[model samples]
Target: MACKERSKGDSRDGDDTWRNTSLAAAPASRELGKAWILKRLVHHAPAIFHSFDFPAFELGNAFEDINVQFTEHGYILVGRSQYEAAEGPAALAPTFAAFKDNLCSVLVVNGLEPVPHETVVESSKTATLHRMKTWRGEGVNLLCGAVMEPTRGILVAQQIADDDRWTYSATSTQRDRMLWFERVYLPCGRKCVARMLLVRRPTGVATSPCAPHWKPRRRGIAATPSSLHRNRLQRRGRDSREDGMLVRVRGKILLY
Candidate 1:
């Protein structure tokens, strides 16, 4: 499922580097899902670049389902196992660091405004790429691929937004991916903070709204995740709570 997004002209060794490298995976939703996945992937680059050991955040079924496909051309990384096997553990930190540095440079210099989420969702195309400034004033590139299937969406993006800098790849399975959508993303609000608050629940906390043990009570009605989400919000009075701080960004009422 992995393929390279290469630029027009490059050396044979560069080509080999593309063959050797790959990226991460993403969520399938337009507004929250696409944005959430992109931010996570951007954060992940730095973590992979700095650490020799594979981080705990990169493990689990949720991450495993996401394959970070690059939009430009350069060397990203393949997978954890393939990377370690082919390049040895020592090559990881330095190689990933190089990729991160290069990508950051491009994003910082050539960035543009973020495309609206509604535009991305409404587009009838295979993919949509947006340009925007990061909070740090660095540039960010956002690419949301179309949801060809109802249950899944793919995203490919880079920070240093150039066509000649980084290579990307992807792989997928239909099974556990659905589990990720159900368990994690379904309970979230319009922004990423909802998931973070949900994750901070204490151990043995069964009442946490996103508790894995909780299930829908409506026996006869088949429910979509969104409906379940609305139910959770209404039932929990999540619309207004001490924990749900009001934030002003994008003219949206984000329940942080």
Candidate 2:
């Protein structure tokens, strides 16, 4: 889900790289089911969202369902998996809020006043494309397609990280840590900090688009050879010093 530059002549229409690459086309009925499934999944992560007191929400349940679909689909469509995996589910609220805030920051960085989140949330179809493009120019990689939802609105974004990894510096404060590379280093160096922002569209709408690839039955189930290969891949290079960190990062995150 790492963001990459779109090829030249790529239409900034709603159907640009973000939409074409991440979203799956489904009937209204299927979409409802998907939403239901997502809601159920988020409920599983109670500790992550502090849902214990808030009986209306279930953070873990939401994450579990989204993870399943993301793995099957090959990219995350909703929620912040990377942050959640690292900091737990409560991280989603701030991470998503930060994502929105950063979009406005990018606009300001590029010499424009920050657009209000509400305004952006209510942006016209064409304006949505413009905002997304603006974000891309600022080094944000949007990975999700435009998802029109009744409760949450439209969601469109990419998974992104700072491309210039070498310039990053450590900080004493957590907020400082998050903003150090993104705001101070990159901006001072006249570089863009990586980010992702999803576009929100009107609700109850369906449009014509090619459907996403379906997961085959065989691929869903684990086979002996595949399992063995996966185990080997998990354990491979553990003894080698250079490969230790590589294995740690990839291994800690359970894709399944």
Candidate 3:
């Protein structure tokens, strides 16, 4: 019997169908603009600092309570709270003042960059799946979700919450993890967008110097100084054995 060919839409399982619908209902135009701007910025950022590692930064209290205000001249003001120990309000006053000064200094040096017109600003309370979709549209191709295992560390699986339904039904495969945000168009105005599934691997397996928790190993192979000398003598014995074999072969040839 011939195997039945599945229809394009039919191939989408329940989870995939959910993701497709959720992505379709999302604010695509806004995400498209944000994705374009982020792509440009990421391309220009130095290799050391260019990354999608928001999770790492998010863990810090400094990032948790950030506030941004746009000035009339288009400069954004970013502020954070100062960590202070109790000595009374008087003791905390200097700390607060210093934090304000630091905030101003940081804004002067780094916050002067112009905001892209299409950027979408959301709070930390925003749904992860929605953020994933938005980021994916912005040309961030990584997929993030929760998984359960024996031990949970910073690398535990992403959890799908009630507020977001897009990532809930998707499978734990690499192909399902990747999202494609960019579309190419021909002169005729027909557009094609590519989507790929990326297989997830344990982190820090590559040659890049930035692998987490890596340490250097000692160079060279030698049991000890004496053992090294002994191995050299053993190699010479093997060489003499080969030379004796060659001499016997020559004698045999002469006799023939």
Measured against the true structure, the TM-scores of the candidates, in listed sequence, are 0.21, 0.22, 0.17
| Residue runs of model 1 more than 4 Å from their true location after superposition | 1-124, 150-153, 163-256
The candidate that wins on lDDT is 2
Cα-based lDDT at residue 30, candidate 3: 33
Q: Model 1: how far is 87 from its true place, Å? A: 40
For model 3, where is the 10-residue window of minimal lDDT? 150-159
TM-score: model 3 vs. ground truth: 0.17
TM-score winner between 1 and 3, please give it. 1
Query: What clash count goes with each model?
Result: 18, 23, 7
Evaluate residue 113 in candidate 2 and report its C-alpha lDDT on the 0 to 100 scale.
30
lDDT (CA) for every model shown? 0.25, 0.25, 0.23
Candidate 2, residues 1-256: lDDT per residue as tens digits?
A: 2222333464433332222212223445434433433332232222222211212221222211111112221222111221112333333345444444454343232223333343232222211211222221332222222222222222333222221221221111100001100111122233212222221111111111111231312222111224544465456534342122223333433353
Model 2 residue 135 lDDT score: 21
lDDT of 3 at 29: 49
lDDT of 1 by residue, 195-217 (tens): 01001121122211122222222
Write the residue-wise lDDT of candidate 3 on 33-106 in tens digits. Answer: 33433333223222212221122222321221211111222111111121212233232334333322232121
Ranked candidates, highest lDDT first: 2, 1, 3
Q: The CA-based lDDT of model 2 is what?
A: 0.25
